[model samples]
Target: MSDAGKLRIDKWLWFARVVKTRSAAAALCEDGSVRLNGSRVDQAHKAVRIGDVVTVALTGRIKVLKVVSLAERRGPFSEAQHLYEDLSPEPPRFEPPSPVAEREAGSGRPTKSERRDLDRLRRPDD
Candidate 1:
């Protein structure tokens, strides 16, 4: 559907909705967080076409996608998803850190010296 078979990596990413905006896509590329066909791509203008693979290091996640088609405009999620094949592996599950136990109310707050001791326990570097 695209007139041009070739597309800039940033533009493609934005059009596909992989990123929120063209500038955000450019920043992701400029920061050296994007890889094209296994090679690191630091420039947003790097050209991409069908069958190319892109690796994006998003915050707290990594996406591996294969280009399926080129999009001319930013579109809805359903439409944008047609542009690429998602090959990123499922993200590993993370368990939340355990919450610190709290002293019962009316037990009274710890004294200043006791508070310092608790702080030391929490921060070993102190």
Candidate 2:
């Protein structure tokens, strides 16, 4: 059993130092990047309970955790570390960067027009 209290998943993540900030946690949740008890939870204020399994899909990695305690306030690392138990295995190790894609024949920094095209490509089409 954990201390009795309700806390937001995002708040808990930030307070527990699982993420650098509450905003980051919220974004993760919104993007279906976070799961609680095996289901994706998209609300920043979704209540969290002790023993609940939390899964965070981060850049190229997944972090699994078991809720151990709750805290509303962001605190020192020592205090934050007490709030959760990491169930995730170490992230896979990788050697020096391998080329993920073949370079174009004349690849160079994007020109202004190319930058605009890049921005257009990045825009979410509705």
Q: Show how many residue pairs clash in every candidate, following the order shown.
A: 0, 0
* Model 1 pairs whose backbones collide: none
- The candidate maximizing lDDT is 1
Q: After superposition, which runs of candidate 1 have C-alpha atoms over 4 Å from their true positions?
A: none
Best by TM-score: 1
Q: State model 1's lDDT.
A: 0.91
Residue-level lDDT of model 1, residues 24-103, one tens digit each, is 99999999999999999999999998999999999999999999999877889999889999999999999897766467
lDDT string, candidate 2, 6-85, tens digits: 78899888888878978999998999899999999978889899889999988988889999888767889998888889
With candidate 2 superimposed using the best TM-score fit, by how many Å does residue 101's alpha carbon deviate from the native?
12
Per-prediction TM-score to the true structure, in the order listed: 0.82, 0.71
How does model 2 score by TM-score?
A: 0.71
